[model samples]
Target chain A: MIVSNMSKDELMKDIMAHDFKLYDLQLYLNTHPSDENALCMYQNLVNDTDELKDEYEEKYGPLTACSAAGDCEWKWIKNPWPWDKGGN
Target chain B: MWEYEKKLQYPINIKKPDPQMAKFIISQYGGPDGELAASLRYLSQKFSMPTEITKATLNDIGTEELAHLEMVGTLVSQLTKGVSPEEIKAAGLGDYYTDHGISVYPQSAAGNPFTAAYIQVKGDPRTDLYEDMAAEQKARSTYEYLIDLADDPDVIDVLKYLRQREVVHFQRFGEALRTVEEKLADKKFYMNNMINQPNKDCGCNKPKTKDCGCNKQ
Candidate 1:
């Protein structure tokens, strides 16, 4: 789902979607811990999140954290910052 | 769906290099405590972060460090390009040359490898975030020192940009830490101690030794 074929914009959209959904579920579950519909929705969102995460990682380096596989020369330690793109 | 902020994501243009300043400037690339370490330090800690705010801040700051790392790299790369092997050796880049043979890596301007000791993965939000905050200040101070040594206008411009970023990051982390504190406020254990205790069962008791269970006062 997160393959390089997807544009950076699309991948970013998917990431934001998952983040918001994760937060929504967290907030809902905090009060309605037994809502089966919410739980199921949360599970589905989580699975989507994972798949997208994998895709994004394979294509545009990593967005969240490090990879232990050693593909990156500095694998465990590195990233492109918000302003890492250089200049203003 | 999340709307992306395009303004926050763009490439930086480090101006052209000056050979005379290149040698000394490259030192920040791999000196004992340099930008490379700072980037690696924050980026590495995100793996074990406990809170979303902490994770997000780490992600943002870590990303910024990578940019700074590039600025350092770009500075070194541009500086060393035109100089011949003889020139490099004479310029004291001989040590730098022996390690990478002119390849600009993030290891060090001196060519020493990166180490994990530069950062801590304490696994507690409070401790890790506080370390991150301190790290930003230290990095900003380092940038200030670099600015003091630098004579090139382009180099100074880049350094100033980086220094301002450190301040921004410090502020964001402060906000994140407050969020964490707010979450912990309801818990009696958190209310009693300013820092979170490492031993969850230790009940926020202040430790007697240097390795206190809590990270902050």
Candidate 2:
């Protein structure tokens, strides 16, 4: 039920936020593996990142090389790479 | 076995190019104590970890280091982007440019290519975890040096974030080492050999399996 009309930058920003949350939770879980609350939160964030990534890639391009699928002509090379102005 | 995340762990928006800064920062991308080595080290070490907690710790931290590697590469690439040939030569990136153009290559600022020799996968949970902790500190110091050299707020901001992660990683590795030590004590085991044989079929090698009943001599 997600809309696909978001600009590339907006989509990228959303993905970045979710990814950062997952990274933070991952490190926390590394030390506090027994925390049920953190485990639950981590699961939710992982789901969010999955959805955001799917939506972004479908509309714009693959975020990672492996995500490039279905008749795409080497799309990984086509980018404002993460270091590029639009890539970040 | 890793999935690629599209976005950076941090958002890096460098508005200016500074090749001089890029020269030193490239070290973090591929230097001896760089993120690349950190990532490779932990990922490689995870396979032989004696406990589930330590294994997961190494895997997760190793993965995070990959993200950090991307961030550092981003910083170096952005900083080196669009500079004049004269600027490149003046910034002392001329040698790098001769080899890599503006693209990011896995090499230290001193022009040493990244080598697996930079990391140790000793296969002992305690030893590897201790090494991981030390690696994080070395990376943190490198970041501190980069932060001092950087003049741009945006670049410094990202560098600070990366440096802070090293501190957090160090703490986590310390905790993992403690967990391994406690497990060793509970089993009345001492790691006497430098060569770790975590996969010995003998039940003594397994930490979680209680009552394997192989008494250490």
DockQ of all candidate complexes: 0.08, 0.58
How far is each candidate from the true structure, as Cα RMSD in Å?
A: 14.2, 7.9
lDDT of 2 by residue, A1-88 (tens): 3666778888888888787777777777877889999999999888877887888888788888886765847787776767566676
Chain B TM-score (model 1 vs. true structure): 0.71
Q: Which digits, one per residue and each the tens of the lDDT, describe model 1 over residues A1-88?
A: 6355667657756665585567545544543457899999999999888787777667655554444345536532344444333312
lDDT, candidate 1, equals: 0.63
Query: Per the 3 Å backbone cut-off, how many clashing residue pairs does candidate 1 have?
Result: 10
Candidate 2 achieves a global lDDT of: 0.85
Compute the lDDT of residue B82 as modeled in candidate 2. 83
Rate residue A17 of model 2 by lDDT: 79
For model 1, the superposed segments whose C-alpha errors exceed 4 Å read A1-88, B1-16, B27-33, B109-111, B187-217
Q: After superposition, how far is residue A87 of candidate 1 from its true place, in Å?
A: 12
Summarize candidate 2's per-residue lDDT along B1-217 as a digit string, tens digits: 9876556778888889999998899899999999999999999999999887788889999989998999998888888778998999998888888988878999888999999999999878888888999999999999999888888999989999899999989988898899888877785666645337655555544565556465545
* Model 1 lDDT tens row, B1-217: 1232222222334455454456555545665456676667667777886676667666656665664665677666655655688887776677767766766655543445656666677778888778878877877887787788778776787678668777877777787788788888866642644356555665446446867656576
Give me the runs in candidate 2 sitting further than 4 Å from their true place: A2-7, A64-77, B187-217
